[model samples]
Target: MTTSFLPQSPPAAEVRTAAGGHRTTVLIGTDTYPPDVNGAAYFTARLARGLVRRGVRVHVVCASPDGRPHTAERDGVVEHRLRSVPSLVHDSVRLALPVGVRGHLDRIMERLRPDTVHIQNHFLVGRMLAAAARARGVPVVATNHFMPENLFDYVHVPGPLRPHAARLAWRDLGAVLSRVDHVTTPTPAAARLLWEQGFARPVEPVSCGIDLARFRPVEGGDAQRGRIRARLGIPDRTTVVFVGRLDEEKRADELIRAVARTGADVQLVLAGHGAYRGRLEELAAAEGVADRVVFLGFVSHEDLPDVYRSADLFAIAGIAELQSIATLEAMASGLPVVAADAMALPHLVEEGGNGFLYRPGSARELAARVDEVVADGARRRAMGARSREMARAHRLEDSLARFERIYREVAAEGAAVPAGGFTAGR
Candidate 1:
């Protein structure tokens, strides 16, 4: 028997009362979760916690690092861990097909009889679980987290062949989404993309909220900033920080190129790591700006806020982010943002107001904006102040409440009404 860690459990009375006087069992399916550094994992963890706090019983079914079936309870939630393949990277893992595990999941579902099912990915496992839930009369709600374009970098196909493959992926995605009662997306842009790709269900915009209290701006003088910068070996000068995975999709190379064009005395700090780390380092050297660049791989969560506070501006060049949690965290830390005006970034970055935006893929345009933010101290401070205000409106409590409501609605709608029941408005 595997040891279970129950950090804290809600009172039985509270769980009974808020579950609408009925015990609610919500099954959340995902391929990835905690111990994997990604937006999807963070959002899943937060959403599950929120539901549990609201007197709902959540059962998370996800793939484990090792290929085996296991069970555990964490943070007032029950986890059903299945086996998977080990990832190429030391700190990562991937899900795999195992007959034993598949049978185990089926048996668990038979026993639980959950009221509602929620899936977060469009992979094979997600589809299987979603189909299983629907067959059992449980409402399934799937959230689209990955964009089809993300596959282009993995497979080497002709340009014309790429769009065809994307279409096929979307078709498969639509097949799974069509079976669900509703779909949720982190941004309106994402929801529209899903609708355009033939997901006919209601696509709700439920964003992943940030922790305001944990990311608030520092109030002291320059002492905190100076200490952090000095500790990180960042000189006492203007610093632009990029905090995310150092990969092609993140466009860290574009930031290096833009920083090379700027004449101002600014230091570029790249945090996080991935397969593209060496390439980014080489790009910095090729651009003749290696000396001004500092690459810190895999920054811990505890030190992230301090790193954001130490920077004069936060820069990101990616156009694929759904909500850009890092961007929101930067804004909450009182730093003006400079990001490409593509994807959902424009929704977060109000040009010439809270932050600045440049045309995507244009290093020159990004460079110009970076220069503008770095050159004016007063404008930077004003933009940072406005950014913090905007961040406040999207707090964790508010966003989680919206998700709880959606979960309850799906559960109630999925529940069967008695035969010859009184019709509404009769």
Candidate 2:
């Protein structure tokens, strides 16, 4: 069961700190990172870059394509790529654990002796990294990103078998989490979920920040709107945008159904790609709303701001989201959101304030909310303004500052019981 997968360890001395007395180095292990473009990847990338900005040297350990072992510095962050199995649908990869690589990681950690190890995913590589860090007496911090429900979509397990699968997954996760000095979740809802699953680690709730500068709305005459509309082939009348993976969990299909229910002359633009694209397309076609729905798969990072800006409103029905980064981005772009009032959605979407919330899975209610926004230009404008102001609070720097504080606190605490362990049903 034990095998070492790494080719050869890079010289231990090869790893060195860059400018600034940031002597603190953090190793972020995940199954995905930049060039992969998922939530986990985006979070890790931003966190790494943010730490770099604070003068902390960051080293990323992530899965890369086979035979493509490489090293590079991005935004002052160093990435050490390792081989992984390619995902079937998306341009994603899964990290392969090798016993040999664990030794390499141990050597790297011994030399770097990073102040802390931050793990973003609870995958095989992450577990191995956590164990390695523990063995080296390095402090560990883990960010819980994925929900157990997401795994059920990929595995062939039946609904009845989910509890067992979830229990096993959480048990293994608890093992990795117990060894860590601290754990963080994007939202309180996620933290609660962790607690319910029997994880006794201190779980802090901190969100990954949104970039206010890039996401703010632009002030322009009809000319700008006209240009954006022309480019998107959307009529200037009304348009609703859903920016996220078009997966069943995201409920893009639900949004489409809601839009169809509205029967309003509004275009529905579906952004992001996933395994459920074809099914969503089929649903849209069957619903006879195919002509009204536009599929814009995998938008470029640079174009995301404009995409949000071009939309008249943003809507999401996914109840499983810990915190919808897309919703945050949309709000940052000054777009009023119509989100499900379940899980973490209510925390962000304040009804009649910055955005509106419908009951989770209620296509009729979602449709009605969409109609409300579309009908009142003045109300939408007001909500959009509030959204911009609210977004300022969650800027990337602020979020990073919170994390930086946690890092310092955890490092100072030394060996002790995790402070924030969850009490059942708290």
Candidate 3:
């Protein structure tokens, strides 16, 4: 039996109630958070920190980085981490046991009384929290960061049973999310995907924007690049970088094969960690490009901009990205992208304009596209410039402002309702 370190209530400064004044408080619920490297985790952390910067009180409920329950504060946002267990699927992943979770969540909601509850996914944490918030008459805003394909390999689901599993997952998501006040996804394509999967509801598309100011082109030139390269232990060669989880749906094996097929003095740098790392390393050796591939596992948030600066081009073979945040960061860093022509990648990669998109899972096609840009210096620079220009549309400030508006709108509507989100006082 695990001891409960769950706090009855946070410090006064951490959460302010309506009696204290009219400060908008948002409770963000997610199954993952920082120290758990993934797009959803990174986006949720950024959203919380961004809201705090905008003078809104923020609270995040997520699984503990370890198996212990605790409360901690960072970036002016309070984090309520619940007890979790090691996942049988992946080493870096953890599963929160839902048994007796609602009691803790109810205590949290009663103390915080958040104006709006923002759920990042319809998983264990998100689903339960949304239900708890709803029972207390709080408005809930849910974002879909889920893809069945992304989890198939992690859960060891059989190939033949994947379609059936996917349908069940989508139905479960719809049933949970439909109870929320609003639903959003990272891209229009993602929203359409939900609709196609039998979810009949209004789904808005919101870009998981990037911090353009932080991830701009390197100004220190070769000196800075050389320093970053040396620090990362990367060889001085024409580099193609990929940043994200090296997971199954990431299709990093295709990249290894593509690197081998390039048949040039080029290197592929994969700057993230996942369960698929071992397989990727093995694939690189099998393709005879072991020496040409560099694995920089779990790049720090502070050093990631420089990692982008160290590359000539960015490549993503990921087939299930709702909106690839790493791809946006690379574009913001003025690097031409070579992405697989799948999912929402086309939204970011404008073929022959900002970058090129090759047939997904085709190493020869990906190799050709990468070579086309690397071989032509003038074209490469032009594409990089276009990438930067295109990235400006998905600014972090804009996304934050949009979400703030949604929170205010929903909170206002919730206020007009009676206690328990019912009709009127009985």
Candidate 4:
């Protein structure tokens, strides 16, 4: 069972309330946004849209897509893009300059008077947003989606300085998050880790929600299978689909070798991109499964449902996941999963039920588990039924409702920055 810290809001502070049951205005802050494509970006965009649909006005503060404030809008939600420079190391990720960030946020909050502020990270933009919002007497709710390892995956730092770097990162994170009324992570494992690292503030576990309607089994799923075969050029073959960034930590190369070890006539379809893709291709060629493996980088969101529906089974080789959104999506599509036994993945894949959890880094074990599922039609369908059942608890509406309640409680509690400003914890 998971544990959560009760929200500890500041006492005797005024909160911005909706005017006589009018639409509440919400300001969401994040470093990443849509068209960038990552777990954090996708969830933030959806959250904003969900709030907007429920008769709320949402304003998003995120990195500028083109270094200009053309400002993106979706279904009555508006994104205020700040100036950003694309990372030289990571072409897809951009860092918004912090210069005048707090000033701009202060002005925005003062003018808009949003009822609550939700931030998605502790980086430059998010950090500034929390402080500015608190200063303006708005309740703040922050969600952390990355560990230090995940951050360094995209931004390089010296190997020897990592320990000190981690400490520094934690200090910065602690200081900023301390100011927020509440904090959330995607899973219990993640919440526990933060608490162990001296993040004494309130922490809650919220799943990264998936669109259950689109991802679930469609028309007995037979109609989707034929098209998948034609799209990937693999007719009458067992297919294991892995959808996520092809980064080193994701261990896509290891999955390929594991499939090769199985010695089954199975095809591996990878749907996502990262800096490590070249290395993955090289590894595939060396493993002699190059012909069977397909790298379909950056699959469109519209086509993602089909990709999941067409697969016979899904696999997650990565161990660093707090909660695998891809695993949930596959489960929703009525596909059994084979995930690495590490981090929070074990919480989702019940042994001998929906799928098996192989020891992390054990390619042979992973292959054996995956082959077991794909080898039998009856067994596969039974496991897939369990997967669908598991996915129901994580429906998008459930997560959205949880967040909605959090926002309302914090706002009603009237939490605000103390008179002397936030005090940093030791």
Candidate 5:
């Protein structure tokens, strides 16, 4: 487990730079940001806001939501949105063209004079920003929130060729990450995955963490739950809620199938939107559980906690999670989990303890597991308590403190390094 650190006092009013400037700034680069509605974007936004709360000046460079350049301050962090085009594969995704990306990044680097550059992926925006930062002697810290499986649907990689595609993806990831000052993922299992993928550097696991204060067991909010359910158009029933993008890799269809197999008085509620929504709704109808499956598309972050509190339990069938922030949020809300036995999920679940894990693609197995937890009220409450206890270890404050430490260390080191010292290599 990653050790939790108490947050230090906010930094001094100002810090002197090598050029004798009086400010401490961090520039974060991501291919996506708010209104993008994905895990990486959510994490990056939270990270930026958290740093701002700790008295650090934060600037984010990311793709514009509407194909036009703009700058705005939100949640106490400055967002530098670059001109972008809609992705060919996804309706909601936008990608910045690489043709003149470096020039734009260079201008931003020169303007912000960021003390450190923290990148959230190895995609176009992050890769270009890292190069520009390195060229200017700004230390770059990268956090990996990627798995090739997550993109296979969008990229339309054939099933048989997925293995080769994954290999190429990992190699390309490693090449970019190798040039950075530090690398981190959200769990120890994810760190191991980087090593196995041939990334020749020490990787640290940092829990994306959650706001424990806000999401807690709503001990007796039956009225509140009903109100939330009514708002979401979810029928009042024993509900198994899954909160995430209804993406192909998430396998929400499995949840629909499993709910049908249970043949019980339960509904599966999905609270996000994606390309898979139409197909999933069709599958629910085909499985004869269309009425029992509710799609609460794109629930805002503010309402997400109530969404969790409205559930009887939380379930996920995704196979590519590094550390599922949604799962953590559900756990913090005191809901027991039913998850797929793959990736970093095992790190969060204790079989038959706080939750149960079933075979990744077996709807029958998943049905049985979900039934086992929901049938016995006493066991369910006990498991929910355990889930809450487990969630305490991943408080968002601890994550913020740990990241601040890393930023300070890397920034101090960056001050001494010569410009253009970092070069991409395996």
Candidate 6:
């Protein structure tokens, strides 16, 4: 709705600082990257490319694209795809098994001489990247996107052993993150969560941004819109769209139950694939509203805008999201939101301005709130306009500007911190 917060890229010749004589180069390390379809993967990929667009040379180290380790560069962003194995525990995630990053990472840095290293997550790759960078005073910046409890439901950890496992996980996360120069999460509430966990470092909140141009109100003609609505089987009914993995922590089952309780001819569209799909389907059938629920597993990026535009409102039952990129996209696409009040979602969805917030895991409360939007056409459009207005401060360029400032600051400070490793890579 507002591009005022968006930063304009400097002219081609202005890429370098007046004194520096050259553009800064950044090394972005991550446990995930594109084609993985999650927030971390998508954000990491975008961050690298976004930096490149802003006159920064970018390099990335990420999980292999196809389960095999390889190195490649596309669109001027050099990438080192390390060895990765599919996570049997959680099929969607991957584990990077860099046998000895201490040795190889030194070689990479010696050749690239990056201004700074930005690592995503506290996984194996991030731990090794942060260590190798800090050992040479590279001004490491770490961003956390993990929630232990969200993942615990997927693995087969016994109930009695859960407490100790969590304790060990936290211990490991702290050990890896403590060495970084700075830390960030997608929301301030998430920053507080990290603070409560005793993360004794600077914790900043930076949003995982969406491409506003790509997510704006769809531009299809009337006929096309009609066909899309018919194809989605929501010809003239109130459609509530939920876009996320069908995971237990997402609390998608609660959304289905709430839709059933609403009994207001509202349709629910589940727009991603996950391990919990079968259970959600079963729940829908049991609630006798299976016909009202549509599962369009894994919508493509090109087609996602249409899905948001075709809907009357957007809904998410998730409680663990630090920033719901889909919710932001929906807002950009001019739709009202209904979300859980927990975590950072409340930061995006104002109680009445944009939409409503229901108590986490409360089907009746969710239903009551959603029904309010469904029953009133005028209120829905007004709230949607408010949503678009609220999303202005979170534009992608604004986030990029924040990171650019962080990179410049770190790069300057990196020069003062003495390198802790051998300078000459023999």
Best by lDDT: 5
Instruction: Give the least accurate 10-residue stretch of model 4, judged by summed lDDT.
Output: 1-10
lDDT tens per residue, model 2, 189-221: 888888877676657898978878667885694
Model 3 lDDT tens row, 199-230: 76678999888888788987786677777798
Question: Candidate 5, which segments miss by more than 4 Å at Cα?
Answer: 1-23, 221-224, 415-426
Clashing pairs in 3: none
| CA deviation > 4 Å runs, candidate 4 | 1-20, 158-160, 221-224, 231-235, 417-426
* Residue 163 lDDT, candidate 4, scale 0-100: 71
Stretches of model 6 off by over 4 angstroms after superposition: 1-21, 159-163, 218-225, 231-236, 415-426
Local distance difference test, per candidate? 0.76, 0.76, 0.84, 0.79, 0.84, 0.78
User: Which rank order by lDDT, best down to worst?
Assistant: 5, 3, 4, 6, 1, 2
Candidate 6 lDDT, 150-225, residue by residue in tens: 6677887778988778767766777767767667888999888877665656679998876777777646644565
lDDT of candidate 4 over 1-426, digit per residue (tens) = 101111122122322234477777789999887666577887787787766655567899998978875576655678889998886646777878888788888888998898889999888888899888877778999998877776665657777877778777877777778778888999999888787777766689998776677688746455558776677454546779998887777888778988788856888888787778899888889988898788877666567777777688999988778888889889998989999888889888889999999988889999999889988889998999899999998887778778878888888988664332222453
Show where candidate 3 strays beyond 4 Å.
1-21, 220-224, 415-426
**Model 2 regions more than 4 Å off:** 1-22, 87-91, 415-426
lDDT: worst 10-residue window of model 3: 1-10
- lDDT by residue (44-163, candidate 1, tens digit) is 887787678767789988887566768888877898888777654324536745556556667778999988888988675677788678667778777888876654654445688877
Alpha carbon lDDT at 22, candidate 3? 66
Any idea what lDDT model 6 has? 0.78
In every candidate, how many clashes are there? 1, 5, 0, 0, 0, 0
Model 4's lDDT to the true fold?
0.79
Give the lDDT of residue 176 in candidate 2.
67
- Per-model C-alpha RMSD: 6.1, 6.0, 6.3, 6.9, 5.5, 6.3
Residue 266 in model 2: shift from native, Å?
A: 0.8
